[model samples]
Structure formats: C-alpha cells, structure tokens
Target chain A: MKTINLAESTVRDLNQALHDQAIECTEREWEVLEPKGQHNIACGLDQNISVDIKGPTGYFCAGMNKKAHITIHGNAGQGVAENMMSGSVRVKGNASQAAGATAHGGLLVIEGDAGARCGISMKGVDIVVKGSVGHMSCFMGQAGSLVVCGDAGDALGDSLYETHIYVKGEVKSLGADCIAKEMRDEHIEELSELLNRAGVDEDVTAFKRYGTARQLYNFKVDNTAAY
Target chain B: MCGIVGLYLKNKALENQLGELFEPMLIAMTDRGPDSAGFAIYGDEVPEGSIKLTLRHANEDYDWAGLAGKLKHELNVGVEWFNNSKVAIFKIATSDGIAEAFITENAPDVLILSAGQSIEILKEVGLPVNIAKTFNLKGMKGSHIIGHTRMATESAVTMEGSHPFSTGMDLCLVHNGSLSNHNRLRQELQREGIVFETENDSEVAAGYLTWRLKQGDTLNEALTNSLKDLDGFFTFTVGTRDGFAVMRDPIACKPAVMAETDDYVAMASEYQALTTLPGIENAKIWEPEAATIYVWERSSETGVK
Candidate 1:
C-alpha cells in the first residue's frame, strides 16, 4: 500500500499514482491523507485499485470513475461518484446534492443521508443509502436500483424510467409518472442481494418498491398534462 | 456556481475570532466562485435609537468627511464616521430612514451597503482573498458572519452585484443559485414600491424577504413564504441582527451542509468550509432539508418563530 498526503501532494499526483499501471509497480492500494475536503480528488481513475480518503471531500470526488474502489471516511460534497462507469464508491458520512448522478454502472453507498437528487439521471448504477435522501432523489432514473433505509424527500423518482426504488421509510411524494409498485418475489430477492452486497442489515420486507407508471413513456397527446 | 459561508457563534469567547475563523472558510471556495466576494459582520451594537450605515463610493476621492458633516448638520444629530479607501462607515444617532434620505440627497454617488445597529457589509468585485485583505476581514470582530463568492450567472460582475445583499435593516441574504421568476417578481415588487439596487436576481430575493418582514412576518415565516412564492434552485443563508438562518429550494439542486457545535453553528456550500472550526470532528453535521427553514438566534429568549 502506498500513502499519498494531499497536504504535500497535488490532485494530479494522486491521479498519476492511481493511473500508473506500469509493470514495475507493485502497490495496488493507496491511502489519501489530509484530504481536507478538496474537490475532484481521485477523479477519472480507470484502474481496479482501492483508495481510502482519510477525511471529507468537496465536489465531484471520484467523478467519472471506472474500475476503482473509493472509500471516503467523512462527508462528501456535491456529485460524489458522478457519471461513474464502473467500480464502487462508499461514503461513510453524509453526501451533498446529486450524489451518484448520471452514473451508468457501479455501486455507490452512503452510510449517512444523501442530499437532493441523490441518483438523478442514473443509468445503470446501484445506490444504497442507510439514511434519508433529500428532495428529488432518483429523478429521471433510467435503470438500476436505489435502496434507501430511511425516509425520502419530496418528488421521489420523478419522471423515472425502468429504475427500481426500495425505501424502508416514508416518502414525501412521488413525481410525475412515478408511483408505488408491488414488490414481487423477484424484487424482494434482488433487494436482499443488494442489501447483502452493501453490508446493510435491513429486512427486505420492510421496504416498499416504486417505479415509473410507464404512462408517459411514449409521450402521447393524452398524457400532455403530466408533462 | 457560487460559494457561501456563515458562522454564528454561540459562545461569546469566540466572538473576537469571527473574522479570523471565517476568512479561511470564504477562501476555501475560491474555485467555486472567483469573480467577486463579500461578507456581512454583526458586531458592536450601537446605543439604543442609533444606527450604523456602511457606504461605498465609486470615486475614491469622494469626501466622506464632508458628507458626514453635512449629515450631522442636516439631520441635527451626532454622526461619527470612519473612512476606509472607497468605503465609509457612519454611526448616527438618528433614524435610518432620515440618514438614508440625507445621503441620497447629498452624497448621490455613495451606495449604502447596509444600515443597522450591528450589521456591517463589505463587498467588492475581486477574488475572495483580495476582498478579505482589502476589508481587513481577518481583524473584524463579530458574533456572526455570512460571506459569499460569486460567479455571476444572472448579472454582471460588479461591486453592486456582489452578494450578501442588505435589503432590510440588520438583515442580509446570500444566494447560491439563480431564480427563474426574478423578472416578474422584480416587477411585482416594484409595483409594490420596493426599490432595488442592482439587476441581479439575488437582489429580488432579498427584496422579497424585506417586504415580508416589513409586513410583520418573522424570519422563519418570511423564509417559509419564500419556499412557496419563489421559483428556482436556491440555497440561502441569511444573516440577521441576532444570528442567522438557512434554507434550500424544494428541488434543492444546489448543495448546502451545516455543522453545529456547542460553541457555534456553521453553514457552507460545502463541508470543507467547516473543517477548520474547533471541535468540528465531533460536531453534529447534516444537510438541511429542502424548503425547510433552519434558524439560530443569539438571545436565548428569542426562539425560532
């Protein structure tokens, strides 16, 4: 394992170390010290390595990540794990707005609450939040699953499509074309698998599923009011 | 994008260090907004029935002393003034309206930044670090402070366009996101006889709150009404005579985080702004809910109303 002190090293150095796939290199794990809530740390990584950030991070940390495992010990600013292609990013504390936004593939876990638009425009990412999510979480989600152990704010899953949402707590409101759906056995099993992978110990039966009603999928003139 | 930082000290021991503590927090968000920066400090309450107005002139050669003398002669009150470069602060033993009228009629080139017993607003079109140095923000002493760095999406980058907009006496507002309905709202406010300083959308928000507070609404009530009346993505941190308040729009597209310790309650656009505070590691940190008003007051007797 190699240790990189952000206090003494630039974000470029950290990215360089993470992108170094030389044959002579042996270290696969790295520790980021004194992050001090810097923005865009460990961003744009395309390696199957692990990065443990010691403290909080500012906006867009681990953004556009691919094939990397990133863990933040403290809070994260806006858009954490945004547009990620692959790999996992875990925030031990709370996350600000747009967490896991527009990600295609990967698993993003928040042990604490996530701010507004937690999974907005998500394509194919699996997001698990142990705490509450603010307004507009999972807005316009196209695919993948978002599981919340705590309450969800207003307009949950607004304009959602094909995404599966499981919440154990109360939902403030649902957005246009988003409605509560029945939890079938397959969904229950999938939620169980996701919970197990995220290392959360919540009962699958405690959760409720929500998704798009598919009424506005084709944009018929009869459904113009919903627009 | 913009950056905001606010600190409300619960413990009197930290009051003297308010500027020292807030400077770094403002500078931390340099990348978020670098066009301009501003802050409002609440300290040194004037004697009862008196007010302090911080004024700025575009002409550095403007005679602030002559203006102060004229105000004293015209208003028939005691006026003490301190001039710092293009900015002048006057402490007057008179009604704010009277002093404001006098300044408007006499020092037409001067712009009144703020008028209150405790609040002093200093802002300029420069980087956060340079603004801080120009205003000597590190030496200021206050009970609470609210600062902003602007990227200027809705308005031009000018001194008047910088934030911490003071629309009401001892009250100011700093906004992070743009408003969609500011033009219509500004017209509506204008019809109601509300005067605006700049074309910035944020000024309309400040004016709206000022109108509400003048209509006998409390801070929380005004902010609550804003959630319904204002249409946009916004994260607002308001500074009052006593303490401060924070709120986000319903959709909450913008980011905001708050941290509270026994000694203070701090809020910023990001968590890094609060990391330098004492005991932050043990502080209770959370994101304020969208459209929910979170307020803290200095006087224990005055709870959130």
Candidate 2:
C-alpha cells in the first residue's frame, strides 16, 4: 500500500498531481498534513478510486465526483459533495452549508450536522446524515433519499418530488407542499438499509419518513404565487 | 437584456483558449443580448491586469480621437474600438488606485464582469452565433469561462450599453437585474468627477464599486456597500483578477443559484441556462443569501479522512 504525502505541496499541486497520475484506484492515500483554508480538493474524478483525506477541508471538497469512494476524516465546508454521482462519499465529521446540493445520483453519508439547504435541488441521490440538518434541507428536491437521525430545521422537505426524507428527531416545520407520510414497513426497511450503508449504529425501527404530496409537480398558472 | 455566464474548474489547470470554452455558453444565451461582444481570458502565466474602460456615449455623440489620444497618453495603452461608435475597450496600464483615480476624475459608468486566471468573458449584441464565429470562441479550449448576451432596457442598446463592461483594469461585471439607486449614485459619482457614459445602472454600479474598492475595501466589502446603498430588484456576478463574487438585491428579486461540485461551480440567472451538458455529477446546488455577498478564489485544496 503506497501513501501519497501532501506535506509540502499546495492543494493545487496535490490535486494536479493526482489528476496527472490517473491513479484511480490503489491503497495510495493523500494526507493533508497542515491545511489552511483551501477549496475544491479532489474534484471531478470520474474513475473508481479510494481516497482518504486526513484533516479538515475547505469549501467544495470532493465535488462532482463519480465512481470514487472518498472519505473525509474532518469537517467539510460549504457544498460538500455537490453533484456527486454513482459512488459513495462518507464524511466522518460534520458538513457545512448546502451539503449534497443538486446531486444526481450517489450516496453521501455525513456523520454530523449539515448546514442550510442541505439537499436543495437534489436530483437523484441518497444523503444520510447521522446528526441534524439545517433549514431548507430539501428545497426543490427532485428525487433522492435523506435520512437524518437528529431533528430537521424549518422547511425540511419543501417542493420535493420523488425523494423520500426520513428523520428521527422533531421537524421544526415543513416547507410548501411537504408533509409527514405514515412510516410504513417499507420505509423502515429502506431506512435500515441506508443506515447499514452509512455504517450508523442507530437501530433502524426508530425513524419517521417525510416526502412531497406531489401537489406541485407540473407548472400551473394558479400556483404563480408559490414561485 | 444581456446575460453573462462564468465557470471555474475547481482544480483544473485552465489556460489560454478561454474563447473556445466560452463560445458554447455565449451561444446558448444569444437571446439575452444581440448587440456586440468582446472578452479577455486570464491565465496563471499571464500578467496582472487592471480594468476595462468602457465608454458609453450619452445622446450617441462624443469626441473619439481626442479622447483616445488622451487616454493613450495617460494610461500608456492604445485604445481599441470593439463596437461601432457605441463602444470602445481600452487595455489600460494602471493599478487599482490609478483606475479609481480615473473614475473619480472622469466619472465614466463601467460594468465590471469576471476576472481571475479561470474567468473569461464573451458577449455580443445581435446573435451569439455571429459573435462566436467572429471571435472563434467555438474552437478554443479552457477549464473555465463566462459569456454574456445583451438587451438594453435602461441603457442605450449601443455597444457600451451591453453587458460585461469595466474600467480597463481589475473588475468585470454582468448584471441580471436593475438597480434602484442608480440615478442617485449616478449623481453622486458625477459630483466626484467620474464622467458619465450611458445612463445604464450597471455602469453606475461598476463605477461606484470600483471607486469603493480603491478606498481599500475588498470586493465583498464594496459589494456590501452597494447592497446597502443600491436598491431595487437585482442579481449580479462580478469577477476580479483572482476571485469572483455574486450578490442579490435586498429583495432577492431575481433567480441565481450556485450549482457546485468537486469539479466546478456554475452560477446563472436561470437553472436551465446552467445545466446544458451536465458533465459533473453528484454535486450539490444551493442559492446565495438575499442581499448578501459570496466570493471564491479560482482553485481550492481538498483531502479525505
């Protein structure tokens, strides 16, 4: 197993080096020894690879990734895993604002809290935050699954489409067109599977699911007030 | 109506061929502005530059040769006319302070667009297709770019009346909405000896902002000042030499979203205008704060646990 030392290099240098090597998959890991506030690390990798980042990362870390399993040991900044696709991204710590915003497909597992608009405009992805999520968690979500163990902020699932949101804690309030659906056996099963994938120790039977009532799918002249 | 689109590849080594990358995006939003277009693509190896001195003729009459010669002597760069008599873009040699000095003395209304190694702009008046071919934007290649289309409402529809105008130095601006305090600011800037060009609110905002930045405020600070001072419904994105900033008016009256990924961040007036090809996946998208300023550098550093 080779280790990639990023001690002396800037984030730009390390990112370029990784991209140039085309070293998609290996035991080789990049360690960020002393990072200040840096942004956009390990972005746009379309190959299947395993990367482990040691410390806290700045904004837009591991964004727009596909077919790569990236894990962050520390907290991630705004727009963490923005537009991830067809892969698994697990954050061992909390995530900043707009976590998993507009992700088309993939899985983002955040061990801690997520800031506002956590899944805003989520296209098709599954986000499992072990802790709480901030306000407007699922604004204009088209399709996805968000499982939160802690309470969700106001407008948790506003303007949602096909995405299924499951939260264990109290919901402050629901945004327009979002409501708490009955927690059925299938929902619990889905929650259980997601929890397993995220490696959460929490039991599967204790969560409630939320989603859109499908009142605002197509555009309506009468609904001009909503926009 | 002018539309400007800017893109940045988070870690990609973007260089040279900015016109190539910007061509498609400009073409996509041709309907926004149909008058005239121009651009400047910065690179890591490129020298630091100041602003673009945009001249908009009020009543469509002005002294061309005399002004050109005067600016050439003062700023040490020959003026290049980009549009008809309506527009001219000067590649001036000056610092932020000098640029401010020029604005304070002349009080010309400028539109600040995008800057930085990753940001480049392409804009035109009639059709994006014509501008693309004329500039050969389709054949170029770069990791990031921005484009603009113009439709004049408050402005003259002349070359200077389009989108993405600046002071021939550090700042570039593209606006999607109008400013409420434009006339008031215009009067204020005029009193400061900043020459007025067109009656465009975008220019007044740019001029006022450039002057503010020269006063030692960061771009965000200047933007904050504008937000507090300039009223009305608007959304604007500005690019500087190493950074880019986006802001909305007090009402958040216009639509602007930051669709970001590990690869890049896309901001546009409308979501559909941004999601044309969709290369990046699994990226999150969010909205900027109302009446707030958000800025980011060209690249970022990342790691995993």
State each candidate's clash count. Answer: 0, 67
- Candidate 1 chain A has its poorest 10 consecutive residues by lDDT at A19-28
Which residue pairs in model 1 clash with each other? none
Give RMSD to native, each candidate. Answer: 2.4, 13.2
Q: Local error of candidate 1 at B27, Å?
A: 1.3
Question: Candidate 2 chain A: worst 10 consecutive residues by lDDT?
Answer: A28-37
Deviation from native of the Cα of residue A184 in model 2, angstroms: 22
Candidate 2 ranges beyond 4 A from true positions = A1-227, B13-17, B31-40, B44-123, B140-144, B299-305
lDDT of 2 by residue, B215-277 (tens): 788676788888778877677877665546778775454656566776666675443345443
Choose the strongest candidate by lDDT.
1
- Tens digits of per-residue lDDT for model 2, A1-227: 33444556777876675565456444344554443324687787676667788755666888998877788876677788899877878888777778899999989999978867898899998999988987789898988799999989878888888889999899988999998889888888888888888888887667877899888877788879998
Model 1 accuracy (lDDT, Cα)? 0.91
